[model samples]
Target chain A: MQAYLTLVRRELGGYFNSLTGYVIIASVLLLLGFSFTDMLVKLNATPTYVPLTELFYSSYYFWLILLLTAPIITMRTFALEKFSGTYETLMTAPVGDLQVVLAKFTGTLLFYLLTWLPLLGCMVVVRYYTGEATLLEPRTTLTTYLGILLIGGLYMAFGCFASALTRSQIIAAMIGFALGLTLFLLSLRSYMPAPPTDWGAKVFAYIAVGDHMESFVRGIVDTRPVVFYLTVTGFFLFLTLKVVESRRWK
Target chain B: MIVRPIIEVKNLTKRYAGHTAVSNLTFEVGRGEVVGLLGPNGAGKSTTMRILACFLPATSGTARVAGYDVFAEADQVRRRIGYMPENNPLHLDMRVRDYLRFRARLKGLTRRRSRLRTEVVMERCGLKDVDRKIIGHLSKGYRQRVGLADALVHEPELIILDEPTIGLDPHQIRQVRQLIKDLARNHSVLISTHILSEVEMTCSRVLIMQQGRVLAADTTQNLQQIMSDGGQVIAEIAATTEDLRACWEQMAEVEHFNIAPAEGSYQRCALTPRGSFDLRPLVYEQARLRGWPLRELSRSLHSLEDIFVHVTRAQGDGEGEEGR
Candidate 1:
């Protein structure tokens, strides 16, 4: 447990000590701010019944942030360690492979969560300007953040898994972006004009991150998306653990 | 009462995609012993250390560290040993003090213990001056010291250092050797280096490896002794080549002799003695009795380098040209 915490702390420190973490956070904030401004402009031109939380959560900017920031945030976890030759020292230090994978996962997830904190400020700005309390509705805001956490956790795990597959951070980032983009494209199947009927629709709905966020922003707390995200996150983390253990055999 | 060895390996073999790195190697390191692993490149020294450190798995073998099997109880073995790999990889972005503290904590030290050990090792490694400096900014010697400090911070029973002083200056190398000697007072050290004299100066026992096998393993003194027994005796005397050859042939102690012309009318005769005793006195007596002027008569002492070269070259010869 102590080793796990120390490793997690070191992983987090690795990000903050370099320019990678700040650059990621700054780029994300810049993108989010531009998207929020665009959304406000649209809202002013045409008043809609959609709540600010729903409008914000279901925007194209949300998926863009999720897809782009996750790969950047996690590309360094295992890839940089291997590149720098510190992986041998780290793995030989009495810590289990699972602990290392989980620590890195947690650290990246924590940083991913931190990057979205400014989204809350966007909500406050909305509430202050529009004088509407619904933007800050306690239940809706909480569920939206929870949904964001689940989806972000899954994407971060995918990035970490990609990072474990190679020593080059660029290759890791490319693989992570490719994986996340494929999932996003798959989820886009639900948006097709002639979407499949019955079971195919259900399958598309099951994996659609957009649909899951829409449900959460509407103040619904469903267990299916929660379980699905957690299961896939766990699976990716398991794959990373296996990759870390494979170092000894190789 | 019997004390168990800190490290024991039997029939250890590590086969990669095409070649075997370590082949049926066997050795033991007793408690508080400083063992030097001297070998040419690709002799499986690093491979063997990696297996014992639990960083690599052997194909067919059993290695036990501190009474725990390395493959089965790797964490137990890892906790008992501190390993500094080749090149001394470190977090370049971190400060020296922070890196040491982080490593200490990762090695399972408590917060308080981590702080204390970080301070202790920093002082011992002469890293206190650059504690606040980023590791990437430090010189190669200082970076190497940080790596050493990190290995020592955990206070493990055994410390595995691979080429710890490879790139250091002569003064830094001496300091590291002295530090290793000091470490031997409490903890066992397994050090591998291409520097033969460093091993002669520091190690209590030496393991000379070649082609993934132990070519020779013994006390440093004993290894030198084995080489010096048949060591050469060189003498410079004013004598003809034929006379020198005939003289050496008549001496029962001379196994083989070579006579080469020296400055003007002088001949340099090098004789390999059959026995371990010094042949200088006999050569001097022969020269005096023959009324020949003798300038130099000295038994060439074999250093660790000679023994290393001799043993490695002897093994290379035994395996024939195909082994190359």
Candidate 2:
């Protein structure tokens, strides 16, 4: 357990020490701030009675930004180690393969969650302007943050898996972006004109990240998406561990 | 008291997709013994070392390091071995001190122990000056020291160094060699290097491997005796080629000889005698009888390179020729 925490701490320090990490944070903050202001301007321009939290969460760009940024946070997780040949040093340590994977997964997840803190500023600003201390509607906000974590965890795990597959950070980032885009695109089946006419529609609806967020925005906490996201996250992280171990043979 | 060897391997083999890197290798390093794994390129030295270090599972057979099976009890084995892999893999982004501390902690040291060991190892490896420097910005010598410090951060029982002095300047090489020799006083070290002189200077026993197998294993002095068993001599005579050839043809001990045209009116001759005997005096007597001015006559000491070439080429089936 201590070894795992030490690895996690090192990984977190790596994220903070590198320029790519700071760039990701800055870009996420910029995009979220811009989108928040745009949503506010549109909401105030029109007297429509849209809920403030709902208005903040409705932007399609929110998911797109996350899909793009997930790769940045995770591309270096294993790829840089492999590229620099530190993987050999890492594997020969007393720590287990599962521990290394878990540490990287958790560290990136924490950093991913931290990037969303700036969005809370939008929440605070909205509450202040509305002359209400609790404009976020507690239940809606909690469920929405939970949805963000689950979905983002899944995306970052896929990025970690991608990083494990190759020693090139660029390739890892590309694979992560492609994988996240695929998941996001799979969810977009809900908006399709014909929407699948069979069980496919149900599967897509069940797995659609946007639908899950929408439900959370309506203050509904479903256990199915929680199980789905957590399972996918665990599966990807398991694949990452396998990839790390199999590299020895290659 | 029965003392177990620090490392023991029996018929260990590692096979890649295209070829076997190490095959049917068996050896052991006793406690406090410094063993040098000497081999030419593509001779499975690193493969064997990696197996012993618990970096890769062998394809067949078994290896035990520090009383732990490499395959079954890898973590325990890892805890006992300090491995500096080929090319000295290290985190280039971290400071030297920070990297050592991180590695110490990762090796399961407590906070105080990690800090103390980091300082001790940094000083031992001559890295105190570069502790605050980022690894990537440091020179190759300093980085190599950092790699050494990293390997020693936890002070494991067995230290496995693969090409520990590779690519270092002569002074740095000497310093690292001295440090390794100093370490061998308290720790069992298995070093694999192309520099045979390092082995001669530091190793108590040298293992010469070729074609993924042990060609020879003995003390440096004993290996030199084996190398010199096929006697070799060199002579420089101020005589015509035919004259020297005729004189050489008279001696029964001279098996064959090669003469190269040297400076003005002189020729250099290399002769392989039939038995391990000092043939210089006989060659000088022949030169005197023939009235040939003997410019130089000396027995060529058998060097490690001759042994390496002889063993590697003698068993050459043309399979283990791939670059490692």
Candidate 3:
């Protein structure tokens, strides 16, 4: 347990001590600010009343920023350790593979969570500018935040697994971007016309990240999406542990 | 000096796809003994050290470190060993104190104990001045000291150092050498280095490896004695090569000799005397009898370099086929 925490602390320190962490945060904030302004402009012009919180999740810019942030936050988790040759120092220490993997995953996940905090800031700014007191509904707001957390957790774990697959950060980022984008886009099949079979529709619904967020934004806490995200997150973290362990052998 | 071996290996081998890195190696380092693994590059020194450090597994056989099996009880082996790997990899972003503290904690030290050991090791490695400096910003020598401090943070029983002084300046090298010597008083150290002088200065016993095999293992004095058993005689004769050869051939103890053209008419001849017999007097008599002017006469005892070259060359060619 102590070894796990030690690794977690060091990993967290690594993210903040370097330029990568600040750069990712700055980029995400800049993109979110741009997206919030665009959303506010549309809300002002629309005739029908739209929930302000809906704009936070419905904006294309928000999803794009999330996709971009996945690789940035996770690219260095394992790749930098391997590149700087610190992997040798890390593995030779009396820490298990699981502890190392979990620490790195959770550390990057914390930074991933921080990127979303600015979205809330955008929410407050939007509320103040529009003078809408009821814009901050706890039920809808909390579920959306939970939905983003689960999706980010899964994406960051994918990034973690990609980083462990190689020592090059560029390649890790590329792999993470490719895998994250593919998995995310695959979920869009749920919104398309009805499939030929019932199981096919179910599979599409099961994998659709957009459908999960839509359900969450509607204040529905279904077990299917939660189980799907958690299982996928756990599976990727497991794969990361295996990759790190296999490095010593090969 | 027959203390129980702190590290014991039997028929340990590591085979890659195309070639074997370590082949049927067996050796032991006793308690408080400093053993040097001397070999050229690609000679399996690093491979053997990695296997012992539990960073890599051997393809066959077993190794017991601190009385625990290397494969079965790797965590226990890791707990007892302070391994400074080749090139001494480190987290360049970390501060020295923080890095050492992290390493100490990872080595299973309590918070208070980790801090204490971190400070103690930093002082020991002459890193107190740069304890707060970022490792990446430090000079190479300082960074190397940080590596040492990191390894020593938990004060494990067995210390494995692979080329600890490879890139240090002479002054820094001497300081690290002195530190290793001091460390040997309490810990059983297994150091692998191509720098023969480092072994002579700091190690108690030397194991000469070549082509992934142990060619020789013995005390420094014993190795020197073994190499000197086949005595060599150096004589500078002021004569033609033919005349020098004739004079040397007359002596029954002189098996064979190499003659090189020296200044003017002088030829430098090196004679290998047969069966440990002193051939200086015999050569002197031949010179006196032939009236061949003798410029210099001396007996040459083999140094470690000479022994290393002779053994590695002789045994290397014989085992080349087996390695592939």
Candidate 4:
């Protein structure tokens, strides 16, 4: 337990101690700011019945930021340690492989969530300017953040798995970006013009992150997406643990 | 009562995909003993140390550390051994104090205990001044000290240091040697280096390896005695080279002799004895009986370097013949 906490603290400190953390935060806020203004302008031009949170989630910038930031945030988790030769030192300690992997996953997931705190701030700003308390509806906002957490958790685990495969951060990021893009594209199959009305479409809809978030912003709490994200996150984390252990034999 | 050895290995071997790194190697380090693994590069010293540290597993053989099997009870073994691997890898972004403290905690120390051990090791390693400096910015010597400090923070029973002084300057090497000697009072140290002088100075026993095999394992003194059974005698006498060679050839105790002309009429003769006996007194008497003026008469004992070279060279020849 102590080893796990110390590792987690060091992992998180790794981000805040360097300029990477601040740069990530600044870029996230800038992108969200653009999305917020665009949403407000569209609302003023032709008022829609959709809530502000739904409009924010529907922005192209939102998904782009989510996909890009995950790879960036987790690219250094295992890759930097290996490149610096610290992986041997870390693995030789009395800590278990599972502890190290889970700590990294949790640390990156927390930092990923931190970059999205601006989404709440943007909501507050929208509510203040529009003088509409409905824009800050408690249930809708909570579910939206939950969806963000689930998707962010899954993507961060994927990035960590990629990082564990190599010692170069650039390669790790490229692999992570490719994996995230593939998953996002797979989720888009349900939205095709001639979507297949078969079991294939059902599978696509089941894994579709877009449809999940749409229901979340509408204040619907479904168990399917929650289970799916948790299971996939667990699977990737398991693979990372095995990778760390396999280094010993090799 | 019998005291158990701190480390014991039985036929330990590690094979990579194409080649064997450590093959059928075996040695033991007793309690409170400082053993030096002396070998040239690629001798499998680091690989053996990694297996004992629980960082790597042996392909076939058994290793026990502090009464625990390395592979079966790795966690128990890890907690009892402090390992500073080759190149001394550390998190460069961390401060010295922070890194030591983190390592202490990772090694299973409580918060208060980790803080106390961190301070103790810092003081012992002379790292108090730069405890706040980032590791990457420090000089190589200071970084090496930080690595030593981290290894000591948890107070393990055995400390495995792989090539600890490889990159240090002369001054830093002296400091590190002194530190290792001081640590010998409380912990058993297993240090590996190719420098024979370092083993002579700091280690109680030496394990000389060649091509992933133990060439010789004994105390430095024993190795010297074993390699040079009767030792060698050097004498400078006021005589011709031919005359000195003739005189040495008549002595039954002398096995071989080399004589060369020195200054003026003096001749220098080096004599190897036939058995484990001191030839200095006999040489002195022979010179006095002949009424020859003798300038230098000394018995030269073999140094660890000669034994290391001799043993490794012998092994290399045996391997060459096998290959043929």
TM for every model, in the order presented, reads 0.96, 0.91, 0.93, 0.97
Ranking of all candidate structures by their TM-score, best first: 4, 1, 3, 2
TM-score of 3: 0.93
Candidate 4 chain A minimal-lDDT segment of 10 residues: A192-201
Compared with the true structure, all predictions reach lDDT values of 0.90, 0.87, 0.87, 0.91
TM-score attained by model 4: 0.97
Q: What is candidate 3's lDDT per residue for A1-250, written digit by digit as tens? A: 9998888888888877888888888999898888887887787788334455666667767579878989978999889888887887788888888999999998888888887898888777777877776676678789888988898899999999999999999999999999999987888888888855778878988898887888787678899889999999999999898888884576
In model 3, which residue pairs have backbone atoms overlapping below 3 Å? A187-A208
lDDT of 1 at A112: 92
State residue B65's C-alpha deviation in candidate 3, in Å: 0.5
The list of candidate 3 runs beyond 4 A from truth reads A46-51, A128-131, A195-197, A248-250, B1-3, B236-248, B258-269, B281-297, B320-324
Residue B302 lDDT (model 1): 83
Best by DockQ: 1
Give the poorly placed runs of model 1, Cα more than 4 Å off.
A193-198, B275-278, B321-324
lDDT, model 2: 0.87
Q: How many pairs collide in each candidate, listed in order?
A: 0, 0, 1, 0
At residue A226, give the lDDT of candidate 4.
Answer: 96
Question: Which has the higher lDDT value, candidate number 1 or candidate number 2?
Answer: 1
Give the per-residue lDDT of model 2 (tens digit) for A42-131. Answer: 867976455556777777657867888999899999999988889889999998989999999999999999888888788878777877
- Model 1 lDDT tens row, A101-141: 99999999998999999989988888888887755788888
Candidate 1 whole-model C-alpha lDDT, 0 to 1: 0.90
